[model samples]
Target chain A: MADKVLVFSRFAKSMLARFAEKFELLETGGKPANEVFSAAELADVRALLTMGAQPLGRETLDALPSLGAIVCYGTGYDGVDLDAAAERKIAIGNSPAANASAVADLAMTLLLGLMRRLLPADAYLRGGGWSGARPSPLLRPPRGLTNARVGVYGMGEIGRKIAARVAAFETDVAYHSRSRHDVPYRYVGSLGELVEWCDVLLIAVRAGPDTERIIDAAMLKRLGADGVLVNISRGSVIDQPALIAALADKTIAGAGLDVFEREPYAPDALSEFPNVVLTPHIGGHTLEAHVAMQDCVIANLAAFFAGKPLPYLVKR
Target chain B: MADKVLVFSRFAKSMLARFAEKFELLETGGKPANEVFSAAELADVRALLTMGAQPLGRETLDALPSLGAIVCYGTGYDGVDLDAAAERKIAIGNSPAANASAVADLAMTLLLGLMRRLLPADAYLRGGGWSGARPSPLLRPPRGLTNARVGVYGMGEIGRKIAARVAAFETDVAYHSRSRHDVPYRYVGSLGELVEWCDVLLIAVRAGPDTERIIDAAMLKRLGADGVLVNISRGSVIDQPALIAALADKTIAGAGLDVFEREPYAPDALSEFPNVVLTPHIGGHTLEAHVAMQDCVIANLAAFFAGKPLPYLVKR
Candidate 1:
């Protein structure tokens, strides 16, 4: 019999087809594991597949006595409780950097869309505002990408890609991260300094205790009236309430967001802002990205089942 | 006395303030010059400022007996009758390449917006479709930029910039232009070949007799069903009806258009397609681009008024 892999998160059925072909899947359909399966069935589960943004705490880990590995489906592994997993001696693996280019592409998409007033421009044209020769403040010329200062909030794979993409647009790029890497762009020591110095701040940092709610009201203020913010990272990295207040008072010019504090549930207040561009969290939701990520997942799972270390294991 | 400059196109008063400070302005507000000013007044005009897309024919040139210069406000001079200007000994001038970077940026914006399905994603989130778990084929995975083949249809400043921007995304860049240039990208011998080989086609060729309606139905068909098209060049380059048919029949995946054959008037047929991202001709409407073009216009007009050759003269 194939080794059983328990599905611990809500994923499209098609996304798990390959996994099912290779393993016996005890799919919970994003329900509580205890509610979906008996303790006897859970006792046989040796591995779990999960979305990296969903919380996988000690309680859930305790329920699966035979669980030896937890594999995250995407780049992030933040939702897994590292301390709990370490105590249980469970190996963790994630598809790091597999979706970096796709996420970076979306960052540029959001930044350009916000700065260019794309949503309003589309609305204006579709509503006959352009043909009627109606004066619209929304369609007024915005600052172009040339010579704009761009501050990247992380230096990971996604951040590096974002820097490279924006740099080609003739913008000055700088980044603030846990440690400076040997990237071509300049490195800034602090997030506050980076925010103050740049016209746009792009959040690509990993979410954890250190990064959660770091971009608070004070940070938003320093971004200034002409500044724009774009977040493709976890929404917890920014204080959504603070961001909403800053936009309300025009403290910042605009924002482009793919993630929210709550998934698939951005506050209604965000829709009211004319200066913002919001999308459902889909920074890495590309066909190419999915294939790359799936490849990593398969490799990790295959290694674990063969009694070898995961080739894409997440470091402690 | 200051030189008299007749305005042949509609312009915001603020855009003309600098010119007003240096010249005596006769603003026609985009009206017929004959109706806006008497023959005597027109005869006294030594220079005229116009949008490059508006037609400037022999009749208008003959009306201005002492017209020494025709200064186009933007990079394009396609609308100006170069033969008529030469016959009348009028120095034709334009802001060549002043808005190339801005236009190139928009080309990328439209390309990303369309391929990423930005509009449908935005609407899905804003309309609560995401929260409702409604299935949207529009939000399905798109072809990512990494390793994708990108074919540029022109080799001008804008096309080169587009190639550079897409290259940074790790795409395979190639181009087909009137003549081969010393660019780093691979040169395809024909437009049909470029279309066939690439996943995306970016149109950046100039608008003129030689290039009008070049992207007809057959070329689009060669682009294949998964291919995307982004046009930042003149709308006359693509057959609108053919594009509509191609889009309706799924000959192409999607399109992002910034220009149309008619000013400020996109067809109602275009509004029905969810796959396409449409914007008014605001490709070069950034503040920085406008300032650069204005500076060029001032330099060209100043040189003409000083009885010297126009600094930014359009070649005969």
Candidate 2:
């Protein structure tokens, strides 16, 4: 089989450079995304790779009769219709730790940036916004990471990695998980108690059926007004409305979020707050993650052809 | 005989909160920062506690006819005329390691941010930009802290502490100092050679009259384009024009600098690039540093009254 592959996500030219050497890769040409996914085009493809936060509907899955496997370009395979694929025995694969360090690096960056007001302050200086560039009293008085009580909710691969990085700052770390992890840090057995103890709370747990609305108003209240909250996991993992209200009322010091409740959409209330640092979910988007993910995709393809176990079989 | 004291820079309100428990402290809070003479203000005040980049000039020195001691609220005493105070047999004290971990914390944050372009991507996303939010092949992949070559420029308290932290990241650490530090890491004999070997270079050396413009354009290029340059030391330590030209021409890959050549001032050329991450000089501004600095100030004051040796003394 000459192995035809369809790519739906944006990636470095480097990935295509690799694909060109082997597979008959169906590249998403410079055509805008809305023009993609014509039914006639999907009929012959043997494999599909996609990303983002929505499910590729059943109709699209039905259209590709030759599709033998689907590779999620990055972590968070929430968009892939796993049930239909499972029924068809079409394999599904996701690159997990491939983007782990990248996302972990970004989470810490956002935490430091918000606490220090890095972007606004840097922009102020670069734009000549400062006559004297009088340092803000708020910026100067904020505390560093030493001995900070950092709470990690959802102790998974990314959370564990982030904990290791946070520990390097000499921060006291703890986590709330389905059960206690084998790690050495203090593990808080209860969710509310964990929120109360942490100076900074990061949401890295999976955002799904079990995790929806996990950090609601009551949890936000437990986090206290002096605390900072960082969410890079899933948009629904945080209750956006309550978070906005808390930030507006000074019930929380600040927030740094990568995922939003809605894509291409943000509450004006969240955007208006100077203390809240928001990103459009680019945490796992580093070049290092891209190439590693490419390797995993190749591994998955190689296994399917050999009739061996899939390297990263999606649980869902 | 009452003990007389002097203060250099203005102290934060938190200092009063923490230190007013003991000692009669005086601040230089008048107009004409130079005119806010620490020595003159503390003509009779028992202890002088000052902070930040303010100067302890001759007017203040001569005015304090009864002055017996001086205490700095921060790690640096460059602004203080230490020689003149020493000539008068004034006991000079400072807070060192108390503020070190905080600055080291920021250094790592900057290291991760600049190497990863955290702020620019966050800003782009929060501004309603979504195309770049997902991980794509176009993105550079993430690199782990495992086994990377990291260089430390200074061997002072902050540098030493940073070395300990860097080791936790599994980075092979090397350092360049005026003398070979006995720390566990490899000590490079020359600054030029250290730059050549390090994939990531951290500038943590103390700033004073003798150390200005040590890293000129030639040094930046030797690190090569793939190397990351981090400056947590004074802005003047690195030549501004040379760095700006080098960054603009792409001689180096990226830089993360907290202290700028002319702080409240950044290179106009740097603003155009997304790779560089800049912050207002905040290495020592964490809350932990603040409280610890206050403690150091208080300790120095206690030592002055008790006639004990001050922990940190400037070399004349």
Candidate 3:
């Protein structure tokens, strides 16, 4: 008999087939973890495969008495109860750096979009504003990205990729991280200094207790009236209320946001702001990123089942 | 007394002030050229400064008997009758490559926006599509720009800048030009071959009698269903009707367009297409580009008055 594995979230069809080859795959289809499987179904489950910010806590882990491992499909594993899993000796593995390129691409997309006033410009042209009797300055003239100073927060894989791409545009690249790495980009020791130095500040930090609301009122003020903010990391990194206030008051020039503090619910105030560009949390939603993440998850699961070290093991 | 120069187009205030230092500046304010000045005004006009696709034929040249030179503000001068100017011994100068960076930036913005499905994605989230009971795949997943082959239709200054930028993303860049220039990018001799070789085709050629409607039905077919087309050059280079049909039928995956055949009029057919990203003719409309172009115009005019070799002379 195959070792029973509970799929707690949706996986691509190809990934599902691969999972089935190694285990008796039981799918939750995004059902609550405890509700999806009865006591009898949970009794033999050896592992759980999940995606996104699904809450996996002590209660769900207690239900699966035989559960030896939990594998997350994407880089972020903030929702998982790491301490509980650590105490239970149930190893947690996440697909690390799987969608770095996709996220970095999005950072550039949002930056360029905001710089070009893409949303308003497209709307103006489509609404026949361009054919008016007089030329309307409906679309404000854009500032060029070339030779502008770009400061990246959290100099991780995604941030580095963004820096690399912007350098080709002749833009000066800088970064601020917990610790400086060996990369050639100028390293500012603090986020405040980075904000003051850059015309555009791109956020790419990982979300956690330490990082929550790190970009608060003070940081926005430092960014000043001409600075633009682009966030591809978790929305929790920014104080949404502070950001909204700053945008409204023109304390900062504009923003391009992909993630929100409340998922699927961007505030009406943010949507109403003409200078801000908003997209649903899709920074890493490319076909390439999806496939790579799925493959990463499979590799982790295969390694764990074979009693080999997990390739992307999450340490508590 | 200052030498009298006819300002046939509206110029930036800075440029106008500079022109005033050397000449008695006569402003047209975008009026019909014939109506803007009487026979008295035309007789003493020693030079003319104009912009855009303004028609300058034998009639205008004949009227301005004292017109020693004509300086165009931007690169495209197809509307100016070179033969008429040559016959009259009139020197023609243009601001060659003044706005190349701005145009290249917009080309990338459009390409990135289209590939990432930025338009529909922004709409979906703003319309609260993400709050639905199940995720709607309203926006198609994008293919990665990294490692993709990008074929530039013209290897001019703007095209080369785009290639340089994309190279940092790990994208392979190639081009099709009338003659192969000394560049690192592979040059394909024919447009058909370039279309076949690339996943993304960028149109950046100059529009002329020889190049009008260069991209037609057959070229679109050769681009195939998976390809994307980006045009930042002149709209006259594309057969608009053919492009519309191909976009509607998915003959090409999608397009990112900044120019159209008709000046300020984009068809309702294009505005209604979900896959295409349309912007008005603002490819080089950045503040930096505007300032640089104004300076270029001033330099050309100054060079002519000083009797130096024309800085950016256009030969017939």
Which candidate gets the maximum DockQ versus the true structure? 1
Per-residue lDDT over B63-142 for candidate 3, one digit per residue giving the tens place of the 0 to 100 score: 88888888887777776898889988888888778888888888989998988888777777777777653465544467
Alpha-carbon TM-score of each model against the true structure: 0.99, 0.89, 0.95
Question: Weakest 10 consecutive residues, lDDT, candidate 2 chain A?
Answer: A28-37
Model 1 gets an lDDT of 0.91
Better of 1 and 3 by DockQ: 1
- lDDT per residue as tens, model 1, B34-106: 9999999998899999998999899898899999899999989888999988888888899988999999999
Q: How accurate locally, in lDDT, is each candidate? A: 0.91, 0.75, 0.84
- Per-residue CA lDDT of model 2 for B1-316, tens digit only, reads 3343343454555557666556444445534433665444545654566654556766766766666767777787766787788788887677877789888877887787676566766656656555434442225544545567999999999999888877765579999899987799999999999999988999999888777898888898888887888888788799988888888888888888888766556767877777787767767877778878877777777777787777665445
For model 3 chain A, give the 10-residue run with minimal summed lDDT: A132-141
Candidate 1 structure, TM-score to reference = 0.99
Supply the global lDDT for candidate 2: 0.75
Ranking, TM-score, top scorer first: 1, 3, 2
lDDT computed for candidate 3:
0.84
List each candidate's DockQ score: 0.79, 0.51, 0.66
Compose the digit string of candidate 2's lDDT tens values, residues A134-230: 6553444675677889999887888887888778778889999889989878999888899999999988897677888889999999898889989
In candidate 3, which residue ranges exceed 4 Å CA deviation? A1-3, A10-24, A133-139, B1-3, B10-24, B133-140
